[model samples]
Each structure stands twice: as structure tokens, then as C-alpha cells.
Target: MILPIVAYGHPILRTIAKDIAPDYPELNQLIADMWETMYYSNGVGLAAPQINRDIRIFVVDSKQIFENMEPGEKNEYPGDEGIREVFINAHIKTLNGDDWPYNEGCLSIPKIREDVYRPEEVTLEYVDENFESKVATFTGITARVILHEYDHIEGKLFIDHIKPLKRKLLKSKLDDISKGKVKVDYRMMFAK
Candidate 1:
């Protein structure tokens, strides 16, 4: 099912999501619907908050399967073993490195892209859809995707990662969004 995506300035987007507790009813179904919504919307990742659910959960498939394939390629593989990963009540433990810059964008921020610095790699511990505990290390695009979605669980947006000057320039536009004066163009903004 295609769920309505919450836009920038939505109160839920700025509020920290509550942690998912064990034995939550319909947790499995919720995760499944999140995956369905993500694929239907052509999004590589979707956070619970983005769907107006304030829970520390998100879905990610960052192997570029949603993007166009190169010529002569019969089949495109996302390469990540777990194509659709569900992170619940997640926490990160930095494994190494200080920080590195990477260009980032958000599903909520439509048409905006900017460079943000974050840990190049990280060790994450979280519960799976079945509430099974797990831990793993991630790097590169996968790491980037994880970090991006993780921010949503904490009431943070990618725009907050931009330089002060850039953020200042965008303040008015953000204000318009907060006031519901602008509509988000998801297709043009997220299509790769």
C-alpha cells in the first residue's frame, strides 16, 4: 500500500519518535506496509516519522535498485543481502573514523540536496521486524542510508546538517513549508 508521506515542517517530523517495545500489536504488519510504501513510492528509504508514525523504526534498501540500470545489464541487483531492513529502537556505536562529507537529501525536503558530514562507518544494534536483536557494521552508501533514516527517529532532518549559511538562505522557504504554503513535489525531488 502507498502511504501518505509526511512533508517537511510536519510536527511529527521534528518530534523524536518513541521506541518500539516488544509485543507491539501489528508490528510485523507495520513493517511490511512500510516496505510496500517504500517500493510503491520509489524511495530507497522511509522512516516511521515520515509516515506520521512516531516510532523509532525505518526501512531501507539503498543498493540503487530503484534507479535505472546501465545498458546491456539484464538484471540489476541491489547487492545488499538484506534488501529490506527494518530497524526498531535502534542505536549506533561508532566503530571508527571521525567524519566525512557526503551529499544528502530527504524525502520530506523535496528538491533540496546538500552535503553533510557524518561517520563514514558505524556499528548499529537494533531489533528486527520479528523483534530479534541484531548488530552489524555498515559503510558506504548503506551507511549513508542508515544514518539518514536514523536521524528521522531522533526528530532530525537532513537540512539540519547543512552549513549555517546555506540553512539561513533556506529559512524562508522552510518557513513557507511549515506554514503549509508550499506543496512537496516528491517525484521531481526524489527521482534519481
Candidate 2:
């Protein structure tokens, strides 16, 4: 299920998503489709809003690039594990730290990477597909992805993280992209 990713300028991208109710029909199927679409697009994470839907849901699978390492081991962050995780009506109660900054990019704003400062760690609570409440703590790249996708549900863009100067410099390029006057080289911009 390769869903069409909504680009910038779409109004739905700015609206706060509604929470998924426990009895909502098609919830399960929607999650499945999102996973399929995310993998098909080669994204580490995908949000409902990215697909032009105003729903508070996103999928993330980092195992494709990261794998867990033992304590004191170098670069020990956990990988995607190829399991597509669904976060419905997620809430981040706390964000801790300020020293770490990571370069981030978004599918919606393809081919642009910027140094975005985010909490190095986060505490998140959300409901799973079966309507069960779950809480998890994440750090490093995983935390970065979580925060980025979470912003999507609230109608936020990665460009919003940039300073005024950079924004001005990128204005024309962004405009060209939004108007379909130019094609973004996503691979060159975001390849790890």
C-alpha cells in the first residue's frame, strides 16, 4: 500500500490530528497500510498527516539501520527490527536534555537536512493497535525520529526548526519544490 505523501501547502498538514477511539473501525487495517506505505517509501518513520490524513497516528521502524548494543559498547542504539510501530494519540509528557543536536530531514519536506536541537531523551505514552496503553523511553536517533513524527500530527514542519536566516536562504528553493517546479534529490540529501 504505497500511499501518496502529501506535500507542503496542504491545509491538513497544519491541523491537529484527532485521537483514535478504541472502537474505531479500520484502525487495524489503517496501521497495516501505513507500515506498507512507510517501507515502500524507504522512510524510517511515517505520520498520518504525511499521507494527507488528519489522524494522530505514525509508524516508525529504525531496525533497518540501528541495532542495540550492550552497555558501554560503541553506538549501541536499537535498530528498526523491521517491526512497524503504530502510535495512536501519543503524548510526550517530558523531554530531557539540551546538549545533543542531530541533523534531521522529513519526507514531506524532502531533500533538505538541517541541524535541529531536540531533547536527547523523551518519555512517551500512547495506545497500541489493541487499545492497550504503553509507555516507552527513547534516546538518540530514535528519540529524534519520535519527536519529528510527533510534530507532524500537530501540523509542524522540519523547516520550522530553522533560524530566520536559513529560512530566508531556503525560501526560494522551498517555494520551487512546493510548486512542483523542481524535483528534490531525496537520496543525495538524506542518505546516511
lDDT of 1 at 173: 77
Question: What tens digits encode model 1's per-residue C-alpha lDDT throughout 1-192?
Answer: 567677777778888888868888788888888888777766789999888899999999975642444544413223333245888988987656567787787777765678899876778999988788998887656777898999999999988888899999988877665555655533212111
lDDT of each: 0.76, 0.75
Error of 1 at 34 (Å): 1.2
Q: What TM-score do all the candidates reach, one by one?
A: 0.82, 0.85
lDDT tens per residue, model 2, 4-93: 677666667788998878877887787887887777767889899888779889988865545454444434444423334778899998
Model 1 residue runs over 4 Å out of place are: 65-83, 181-192
Name the lDDT value of residue 29 in candidate 2.
Answer: 81
lDDT of 2 at 103: 82
